[model samples]
Target: MHLTTRQLFLSHVVLLAGSSASALAAPASKTVSLSYIARLYSMRTSVSGKKVVMKNKWNNIEVETNSRRAWVNGVMVWLHHPCRKAGGGWAIRELDFKKGIDPILRSYAYVPTKKPNMVVLDPGHGGKDPGAVGTRKVYEKKAVLSIANRVKAHLEAKKIPVRMTRTTDVYLTLNQRSDYAAKVGADLFVSIHADSAEASSANGVETFTMTAAGCDSSNYYGQSGDKSTKRGNQYDAANAVLGFSIQSNLVKMSKRSDRGLRRARFAVLKNAPCPAALVECGFLSNPEEEALMIDPNYREAVARGISNGILGYITLVNRARK
Candidate 1:
């Protein structure tokens, strides 16, 4: 199923909206970022005779289609914005593919599945950024990249199309990464990183959503008299849903100390157009955790944990939509 550039771009724009970094102006109003366009292009797949489903982990948007028109269940929901090209094509935006669209389709609505979308993986703190340095002199950028590569390998082995924000030790501005993701129309965005703490005892794994609405800085008590601060805006709520689900799944799989889900207005989450999450695999500042992270075997476990979290969220989202 070969896709034209326009169809590919449209799907990515929708997917990327969930995870794309903020500050991208409307498409027609400003120059579209090339990376954004590239991302949209990267996730494109041929849909002919292939099954396509979409789930908005944030909105519980589920929709499925065989071909031609899309249906929520039996009912047809019109596209918010119809594609002018491809003979007046329609697309389902960042929503759950099967379940989210199920109820609507059950209502006898038109549902169409154009193509299968791809996911985006980002390894944080690369090149000049260097992210957070660990007490062991481990570079956050290099460590995250290693983890990200492992993740890419695992996903590809499953035949799930994947893209990396940076496959090498190159530097990319937050906006550039976000804009590119927006353009790519990624279904989901996962940014990998190693955590650092002021105290070595502060070791654990944490996942983050953009933030919950109306709650900028809620102080949650931690074990060491530390207050957990979660921050974001209303725009981040959906991603927050995705974050919690992913974080929970990660804890269950890795058996790591659950730092729980946090909210930080990081560029990766704040500006993303689609649901996005940043994972602090473990505290590099902690000698035990840092030593483990440096090991190839442990890194594989971390990647497996991350992958499980993502697939778990996807599964839950699909089930909920149903």
Candidate 2:
């Protein structure tokens, strides 16, 4: 976490051209078991007769009815935000089941394409969701919207039709956003967010996909309260792959700290009909990075980084189709 300036610069270079996941898997001095995930299977819970099931393929994590929330390795996740303690249980205000979960059940599944079928751009933290707080008193929502607009403009220049969930500051319900993508038949969905951490030292760019379902039993986060099944795993795996490709490119193009790809049962990613990713541009909590993010030049760079990543995914898909 204590990265020197040179080290940070090196991380950027390697992020763009080196440090493949396999290479980063070099034996470590200490055992880094993922507690966030390991605790899911052991999680205490109460069941509502009502149940929701979710599958995310990126880290092969699946949640069935009565599932407890947890993070997935190789995926980016923020434990405290959106979901916070309510009563004796945890609930994410941004992901209320009524608006978020039900939509996934009714939405269409997206097929992979050489070119994106349609691109759905989500500017994170509309309405009451302030997203991450920054060091210079900057709000995550404002910075992301700037980047999202630029990304939209650039994509449109490429003749790629783009749809924005919220073009202005208006609050749109999570269901409405997801439904919009499904309605438009978008091929890919990208939600823009800025990262913040307790430590200002945590500056970086990362992308996230849906959690994978087939994690080894040992890897289960403590979600003991849930029932499990195979059909869920199949659904999660297919989508996770698409999420992975976008995230991999996102990390590469940004050339920031490799937060590594992550999986979570997020509303936007979970409900979007096509491959979707939520990208954290960088940590606005860091003083230096906060200044950078506020600058128009740096904001443009952030937009370009996201656009490049998407284009890379598009090229990969097109090549595979041949």
List, residue by residue over 113-165, the lDDT tens digit for candidate 2: 34566899999887787777775788888889999999999888888889998
Runs off by more than 4 Å, candidate 1: 1-116, 218-237, 320-322
In order of listing, the candidates' clash counts read 62, 26
Q: Write the per-residue lDDT of candidate 1 for residues 49-102, one digit (tens) a residue.
A: 333333222222212232223322122222212212222332432322211222
Give the C-alpha miss distance for residue 273 in model 1, angstroms: 1.3
TM-scores across all candidates? 0.59, 0.59
RMSD of 1: 17.2
Relative to the true structure, candidate 1 reaches a TM of 0.59
lDDT of 2 at 255: 53
- Which residues of candidate 2, in runs, are more than 4 Å off? 1-115, 214-249
